[model samples]
Target: MSYCVGVDIGGTNTAIGLLDGERVAAKESIPTLAGEGPDSLFDRIAATVRGLLGRCGVPGDAITVGMGVPGFIDQEGGVALNSTNLRWRDVPVVARMRERLGVPVAIDNDVRMYVYGEALLGAGRGVRHVLGVTVGTGLAAALVSDGRLFYGGGSMAGELGHIPLESIPYRCGCGLTGCLETVASATGIARQARDLVERDGRASVLREWFPGEGMPGLTARDVSRAYDEGDAVAIEVLRRTGEQLGRGLAYAVTMYSPDVVLVGGGAAAAGERLLAPVREAMQRLLISDYWERISVVPAALGDEAGVIGSALYGRDAAAR
Candidate 1:
């Protein structure tokens, strides 16, 4: 039977899955080691794919590969134009992978793949218009309108993370000051928590984890754990982060008027802790008619959304 291979490449790891129709037949992950550059990374990825196919007793010729890469992508040319996370610049990803795997390859931005997966099989199932936002190491979003991925003129339509917020003083990796992701993403949340602990010298459980002077290894997960323990600082951190995220999303809602806004990614795992404020802030900013018509919820597919979406999209691309 023909199969599709989906690859979700992130800064820290790459997740790969084998899709047998609508169900994931097999899946695995590998350290991205992105610092070693795309060539080394793709080499490992290709090896992993071969191993998976061998173990699954599938022939190489029977599969088409799809990849969801973070950062800017030239989907038509299969080139990773620029990826701050992966530190890639104008890398011809399709040529490299196709040369190694000898299969048809398709690629797109990772968040777009994620939303596509949700739209087809997860929270967005049967929904006509879906807006998916991911809050993780960084933040991003994608839109599916009428069951189709909407790539605006530049294929950069849903880049909500980079929207500048005047109140946010932090500098973003994109070399911008006060981008929304600098405050609303996982990195943002941890930064905020650390700052609060350091600036105000608040007695927070977070201090236990980040006692030392320089930037601590504190993470959003750490903040979540602290929030669970009823740490005042952690609670305040999530509330502010969610409020910023919600305010950022309000702009998307006003423009897209989606039926639902699906939030996903690592920080989203906080569930209601983060979502409650997101809902509140978004509702407060939007008019009653728009706010009442839209629903904000967590993305149902968890980490598998990107892989599933990329694989299915590759399957379609291969057929075409």
Candidate 2:
């Protein structure tokens, strides 16, 4: 029997899944250890894939691999042009993976893979147009129209996180001041919470959560917990962050007019606390026709979406 392997490479962790047709048969995860560079990371991935197949008692014949990478990708060439999260540039990902695993490999932007999974098998199964946004350490989005992923002319579309927001004062890692991700991503939320407690001298449980100078070890999850306790500062931070994100999404909705907008990622786990404001703000900016028809909701597949999408994509690529 043939099998398809899906790999989702993230800045913090890498998730892998093995699929027998449409059903996932096995899964594994490991630290990406990105600082060690691409060669080291791929070595680990190859070993893990071998071990996974061995433990599952499956022969490695007729196997194909699909990968979801975070950043710009050269789809036809199978090269990672640039990945801010992985600190990768001009890496020959397909050639290296094929050498290590001895199988056909396919790749695409991670967010696009996530949207693909949702569009075909999860929340967006029947939707004609789906807009998927992930608010993790950073933010990005993908569009799936009529069951097909849309890659604009250069395969760099849906970079919503980099849209400039002049009102924001923070400098983005991309070297721009006031980029949307600086205020709307997981890291962005934590940064804003830290600034409020540290710079504004705000009275918040966040201070107690991360005591001492600069509130070392603070994270977006901490802010979400504080929001649960009704911390005024936490509420304000999420509200403002969601408002800005919604504003940015308003333009996307105006342009794409998706049937539904699926929001996923670590920060999205805050659920309604973040999405409520996102919906409110987005609707506030759009006219009745746009607001009335669109639904901004949480993604259904969770973390596995990328893996499933990648595997499915690989299966298709192999067939072609």
Once superposed on the true structure, which residue ranges of model 2 sit more than 4 Å away at CA?
Answer: none
What's the CA error at residue 48 for candidate 1, in Å? 2.4
Candidate 2 per-residue lDDT, tens place, 1-320, comes to 35889999999999999988778889999999999999999999998889878988877756789999988999889999999889999999999999998888999989889889888888788899999999988899899998778889899889899998878999988898899999999999999998999999999998987888988889889999999999999999999999999998998899999999999888999899999999999989998899999888899988899999998878777777
> What global local distance difference test value does model 2 have?
0.90
lDDT of 1 at 314: 81
**Residue lDDT tens for model 1, 110-143:** 9999999999899999999999999988899999
Total clashing pairs for each candidate: 0, 0
TM-score of each: 0.94, 0.94
Candidate 2: lDDT of 89? 100
- Cα deviation at 247, candidate 1, in Å, is 0.7
Q: How close is candidate 2 to the true structure, as a TM-score?
A: 0.94
Q: What Cα-based lDDT does every candidate model obtain?
A: 0.91, 0.90
